[model samples]
Target: MKQTGAIVSVADVAWIIALWVNRSIHSSMKTLKWLLNLDFEQQMNETEKIKRAKQIAIIAGVFTAFVGVLLLLNYLQIKKSDPLNSLVLEKLVERLSSEPNNQQFVEEIRQVDLLMRKAYFTSLWQVRTGAYLMLLGAIVLVLSLRVYYGLRFAIDQPSADQIKEKKKRQLTQRWIGISGALVIILAIMSAFFTMNHLRSYEPEKMIVHSKAGDESIEQLEIVSIRTSETEIDTVIITESTDVEVKQPEVAITQQPEMVVFNEETVKINHNAFRGSWGNAVSSSTNLPTSWDGATGKNILWKTELPIHGYNSPVIWNEKLFLSSANTSKRVVYCYDRNSGKLLWEREVNNIQGSPATQPKTTEDTGLAAPTLTVDGEKVFAIFGNGDIIAFDLNGNRVWAINLGVPDNHYGHSSSLLTWEKKLFIQYDTHSGSKVMALSTETGKTIWETVRTNDVSWASPILAKVDGKFQLIMLANPNLSGYDINTGKQLWSVDCMSGEVGPSPVYGGGLVYATNEYARMVAVNPKTGEKVWEDNYYLPEVSSPAYHNRYIYIATTFAVVACFEAATGKFLWEFDAKNSFYSSPMIAEGKVWVFDTGGKAYIFESGSEPKLISSPELGEKVFATPVFADGRVYIRGVKHLYCIGVN
Candidate 1:
């Protein structure tokens, strides 16, 4: 009996020791699984893990294969160059160039060009987006695949066979990585290969006339300079204007890339805002003294504009440029100066940072109130939304930039000025005022100067005094002058008041700044001294025109006033039947003024205001009359009419 009890006690002790050893082994295995981040297997039963791993492996494999196929397709697409370039675009551009007066062909070309640009840019954006998605999908696929493979062999013992399987898995991963890297390389190369390289525009050799009555021929290149992200066809590169320039007291760093502009601005016959150089006068002495729009007498042509805008027209090298916009879209139009036929029109869009919605604007200053200005190369237009863009002479987009939504009570109606290779703008608002100069080559800012006034709807004019060019700006009560190249304020005088709308005119050794119900003052630009002051008839919108030795003023009221250029002595004053918004333009020794009722009052540019003819245009006219090539181009509510005897 004693021997049997001792044996039983020993057996019980052994059984307890065996249970403890088993529990300790399970605890150590759980700790190992947690440390290795294999906790999914620890949380799930054997059957559940097997089912989950199978689902994960199939889904990940299918997704990875699908992404790979997409990448391959995208790569093939990028390898193929733009179909638009080889298709009908080149022929269209050539045909339009030959038949420049064909309005229908011009419209067709515009439509096709818009479509081609949209398609090309969309594809580029797609390729960039797909690359990032492919990389992310590849990473997810590898991780899920590893988890699935480990779960499949969870119950197996470690041996030579398992080690061999691990090596094989690593080999498969290495091949996958290599394939991915190769695809990336091919895609990068294709992106470069598929860039847009449209046919460049080669302008005809220009004939330059010298002061000594000599003629010379010069060749210029208007080539295509491609940008990677949003590449356009070509650009007319000019780094500065042809005006006189002086360095500022403070230094400004210019971009390393600069281009030259061979401009002969002295022989100025072009028509921009205030006519040539904002002077509002032409040297031609053979203009038609008689025209009747109501009777269609001496009216050369009348073409209906697509949209109505308050902005005036600019003429350069027999091409007319202007901009018009409604709430939905903004567009620039180029017309044949002789035939009054539409040459081309391009909508301004795809500009980065452009507002999706336009700001609030009044009816007087509509969305496209600001006039377009053209250098011999590029034509620039700005809208009330502050979107400034330049188009080549052929109407292709060169560069675009947004000046942000202007804080103007009426609307942003500041006209553009192009000098040398630089573009100037007077950005005055109710909040603050600034004068900015942008590079015509890349639309980059060359210099900026801030002003201390607020809320002026007037435009800046470029003036030359003492052989140096200065930018004259009218803001609120102060008229200021700035250095064009350096954007430094030279001088300012408090000579204006009220809502200044009429742009300043510089002539007769003085700068003319005017406002309604305020004094129309002329000041010496060099000394900032008031040369003369006339309060008899101040114009609200009509900027004074200087011709010969007389100053012409057309007020919003039914008044026409003439003043002596040397003195502010009132030469003569007369009140017509209609109000005038269109400024008086001096051409061929005649004063041409269009009223709001669309009646043009032609008078003599002498000390005595002798009325030549008050012809009715039969429509409302607000834009200033543009004199080009011995013709008067006027913009009515819905028509652009050429009034001259051919």
Candidate 2:
């Protein structure tokens, strides 16, 4: 009996130890599962569970506080490095506010403004990202604390009815999760619709030009505003006097490449377009009439220029010369004709009239608005400050002369033209305007004819009229002709009025002159009398080009109008869909019209205006293209392009 009692006691002790071991294993399994999904199950003692819950709450609080500190640091960093402090933005705004009429300045301001705003918004998004991360961490930490406390010290004992109630509560929680997900989905859809609705532009607001006095200029303002959920795009045009505001074309479409013919070799003509009245008929039979810049077809080479200018390039033999200037410096550039490589550049630093001393010029009438003239022996260039500098064939400065600061309100823009061995310059300022002929070799004043002229930007043309070479020029009140050899006034007429920008084109024994706010008149160059006058469409800046009896004018309003040279009859016209600043050139039985937005439109100059092809260079073009030596040279705001095939 005694042995049995001892064995029973041992078995009882073994059972107690086994029960303790099983309890520990079950507790560890429950703790591991709870850590994996944060869903602890199984009954626990009150004091121990409370202690565990307190530890979890402390850890969660610490974690949430740490995340909050990180979020705060991110916000402070973003504020410290704000985009408003950028130097580029300051410079752009300064220039934009000063030159209110400069389109290039406005464009640069818009681009920089966009980039800065993007950076600002990107910083904001980064802060938001940190905020989101912090919120998630806080939510997780808060839930962990709440659950830890709620489950701790709860009663483990329950009846059958209590169990049923618990199951119902679990079912409700499942439904709540499902509803929360649906709400999140609905919120996302709403935000997407809101974004799309906000990303749209209203119609443009156009302001009509005020009808002021004849000498009074009117300021017109046009604004385009587009709103999006994330940003706003606003374009403002503040100052415009005679400009007619039209919306730019909506799209730039890509076209197929046009084949450039090169089967036959083309002969180089040095004197082609040497004068303003560039060969009325092109001798380039194999030149490309149509090209696509986007496809890189027939574009032999393009070289980036260093300065800004409205001066067209001049070609002589195998060299190309161009002039450019800014507020402080002037540069004359030379390039190789075949390779489009810049051979040399010379800078003339002895600028007489400081840019500030000169009167305010229109955006188009920049420091270098006049086209360079070359006579194989020498190249000549003129600036808005009445500075004329001559260079040799190898880009060496030959002579420099300052005619004195011009008093014109719109700056000096008369281009240089050469006749025989004399360089012709029409210095028509507000006062003391004169037409001077300088010797090409020594840059000496060969002949000077002072005239009673107003502030005019007209460049003189050397043409053979009535069996004599006459230099024709136009001003506000009169159109005059001078002898090319002696600077003698051959004839003068009080026929033209308004700011004369269009240089008179002499063809068919008549000189065609037109302006924005004046009548289109056909005058006899010999007698300087109005032969015929028409009140039809006219150009603002672009000069009229003539081919026999057909006269072509591409206006700033983007219309290419044709007229009969003899009778002043209006012919057909075509819309280029963009404004034109560069004058039209007649070449190869086609009329080339280059727009300010860098598009070239070629069409037939005849009774009917037929469409050929429109090529875009993706750059701003303000100078007329030079066609010589079987190649076409174009000057953009930043680059010079030579288009031809070898």
Candidate 3:
């Protein structure tokens, strides 16, 4: 099939050759008939034959010249502007990449691309058909010219002047033959050049290489280190430079022993941004009620992070994972869960097309606002610059790829989510919002679905509601649910607005979503119907948590509010002088909410607000706390502090 397509790539040339071959055979048959004395130049009407031959030659020559000129114009048109490789398309794609959120440009590119593609195939068709007509005209012109000249050159009586005329005719014939050979040679060369040029433009391959520039990954360098007698698993990092690389990639490194390692039982061990299923609730018990960072009360350990980030920490059984970044480097840090000692920190280098300079971002949503996800055997980290890297338990770099620099006002803060072997990425831009599922082991795209939602800062949630798993997402204008296995959107409630920073929560047989300036609504996950909605005490940055029959929200306006999950009734709100950014988490029937001033407000889970204790963790807090093995892991503004029964 490919070979056949290649032949058609130079369709005009192929058509000309085939038609000429047929004409040549016909001319040979006519010559054979004349040689057998079937027709002796029609000597009965000599003058008439000469006149008719002259007229035929003149008409054929004019027609052949016209088609020849037309074909030259067509060739120049193709050579000057290949529709697939048009400058217009290139510029449009470039603008679309930089301004991905611009719907106008996105639509324009898609429309123009469709037109150019139609023009491409149309030009190919015209080339084949027009070239065939031009060749036929040329052949007729040649045959008529032969008939006219042969009649004129005929000499019945042998004469010196006649002999001179014959010699002159022979010289003309020699020059014509040479010219014809040269024309054929040039046509053959042009055909092969064109065939080679159009090889990459396969007709079936549509949508010009992802909207983001081609990911060109030249090579990977894997490096490993060992502090103790564990496997020196190598984490591969790539160097992104001005050098050209193509397309996104995620390569996996096999384990040394290839053991069947699955952390199915350790999911609730603080695996994702919230918990195993994106709900900020844990089943662990005996959590500390109070702690003082300044006095070291109930503080298990404190480690100063190398750099600050807004992303929360994720924990496995014995290893805690977090990521941090600056303008020059994006690094993933792993620490020992027991001692809070830094086990290893590897700079994620060599991503094919990671942005050299960071995009303009608000301080609130720093470069590392998205928290890491540890799916049993391997841990994954994604930065605001659209760089996602995965590493094994022993710090071996599994795979990494740049999702292209996102187009966002506050930067891409949507964290990563994992369910089983599939990883979900919710990339919401102004007009280019979409969801993508990728293989956790290989980083290959499993499915991608374009969305019509507004720009969103909220991450996604994979929740089990109505005895079925669904991927829930919060974006402006809608709270949507999608099938976890496939990316098909199940249901959507168009009741959200503003920046929609808070991720949706599932509780009380409903999903709750809210924004700062918008209303909070609880929707039925199965039917997409709103069960209840409240207009007051909305959250800006902090995600809400559900405990028992109440929904707790920590707002930026110095308040931790609670309401009934089943109804829109407001239970109570804890007013304070400080604002809140960290989300609230539920553990052991207690609601733990943190303020920006590093104060923790613990409340008993009930209809009414019961403030149990207000603890202080010294430094400011932005990332939500993670609970693992009864200890609360808080990613403070400058340090990772563990609160437990110390």
Candidate 4:
């Protein structure tokens, strides 16, 4: 069957080539007759001129025939090896061999056979169009040759009037050639531009949910040790099963108590202090400001440190723990929160193939982008390479686990969150992305759910939907919900554009997620139904912070917008002088926003906007400021500032 089709295609191509050659021969004959009628040609012998014209016509015809044969052979080869034809033949054979009474099977086979035939014809049409183009070029070449020989004959023995007319015709041909070239060039460039534009336009879609119940849980032993210069090493080894409680009680009651003390009653004092980066879970409150210096009356001491990072300082008692990294080295530094003095600095080994950042992102952007989460007994830090390290409050190394590589083209920015005895850290990337839970004590896998697409800069947020705990992950084209215990996909809503960048904020029963291409969407966490979507116009990389009835979103374009959390309605937008990459922190009746240019802007968190202060430090800043102990900790490119009234 294939051989038969090949022979037919060759015959068709041969016919087309023959028709093109016939038309060219006729046009060339007319030109030859005109050359003979010229007065200049009267000087030449009539027989000689006729003989030359016949020879030229024969040569043109022979060359055209040769080209036609080549085209026929090429078409035959293409038809013989076509995949579409093979598929069509296979389907036809299957249909003929089927049972006579099986009407439905016959129809299915017939449809497949029809589609294959259509595809084969379409492929053949494309080849025919290419051949047509060649035929057109051949026709133009034959015409040009006749004109060249006719003009040469006239030029060799021509009248003065003939020479003048020939010059005019040559000038016209030059313009035609130039115009044709320009048209072809423009068509090629237009096609390239259209393809480039299409590649950049990505459609917004819902997040995909993965099936759960496939993960294999493992048990691992964990050991904690306290080493001192004078005393022997104090080691504590606990059994994996005995220590692994279903739920840790420490997480439930650790929420800080909300105090309703008046501004005047709060006392302000500062002194040198030291502590580890233990978990200091503060209670959730709607108070605009929680700091003692809200009235600008209480004066507290301030200090600065040398390293800068995006990780928020975890303060336990007096000492502060934070991580910092540049292109060359990554360091975890301990600082005295009160005196602003460096206590001890430990350098972590750099992992190979880590994401590289521009110079502007050096401070807060590095392999140590995620903030450390502590559980009082040990401080845990997640590196860009998915390495989680644990240390005691006194800077003693506990245990380290290297979770597989993450899928982040920009870098891993998801911070660690602890729920009872489980440490939840999401590792979503361009390749092999998954969200996994680990035992906080033993570092053993609890449950893991693989994701379909890459979530470059977004972080997972834990939310309770309809009284059931679920893991909400912002991924490519969708917002996913997973069962907290079993890692099962509950539901997913498509409401994302471009790369997911913002960590989803849960408030008023809705999950707010934003992307770099400036799409903000709110969806019900339980049902995965979109509440509303707003185009911010400006790119948003920072997560939205919710307080009271409003959610604050900071964009990299230096604009901060406050929207009603329920309806996604814009309340007010503020355009600061510096671009904002840091998430806004609401405290003490104010919204604290740190900019990339090292300026911190404090504004009233209400309908009527009021700027409190925009303090400039002489360096760039990337990390958001954390308000604690009557002061704000601001991390700049070169130094970490403890900002407060002097």
Q: Pick the TM-score winner.
A: 3
Per-residue lDDT value at 142 in model 1 = 56
Q: Highest lDDT, which number?
A: 3
Query: In candidate 2, what are the lDDT values of residues 1-646, reduced to their tens digit?
Result: 2332343344345434434433443454354345435333544554556556555545444443443443344344334544434567678656755565565655565566566556545444434443444344345444544555456415466678877987886698578646644543443343334233322323232332433432122222222222221122222223322121222222324453332212121123333232344333344555665555667677888888878888778766678888888777778888888898888777765533334454567777878888787766567887877678777666556666667678877767888877677888888887677787777765656666677768788777767765677888888877877777766677777777788887777777788788888878888876667888886888888888888688888888889999988898888988876888788877777888789888998887688888788878778888887776467778888888878763
lDDT of 4 by residue, 375-492 (tens): 5555667777666766655565555555656655667777776555667777776676777777766666666556666565766666767877677778777787776666666677
Q: Of the pair 1 and 3, which is ahead by TM-score?
A: 3
Q: Number of clashes in every candidate structure?
A: 7, 0, 9, 16
Q: Which residue pairs collide in model 2, if any?
A: none
> Which sections of candidate 3 miss by over 4 Å?
1-267
In model 3, residue pairs whose N, Cα or C atoms come closer than 3 Å (at least 3 residues apart or on different chains), thus clashing, are 214-247, 215-246, 215-247, 216-245, 216-246, 235-397, 238-349, 238-350, 239-350
What is the alpha-carbon lDDT for the whole of candidate 4?
A: 0.58
Whole-model Cα lDDT per candidate?
A: 0.72, 0.65, 0.75, 0.58
Model 3, span 191-228: residue lDDT tens: 34444556764333432344335342112333332323
Q: Where does candidate 1 stray beyond 4 Å? A: 1-268
How well does candidate 4 score on lDDT at residue 120? Answer: 46
Q: Give the Å shift of residue 134 in candidate 1.
A: 60
TM-score of each: 0.60, 0.57, 0.64, 0.53
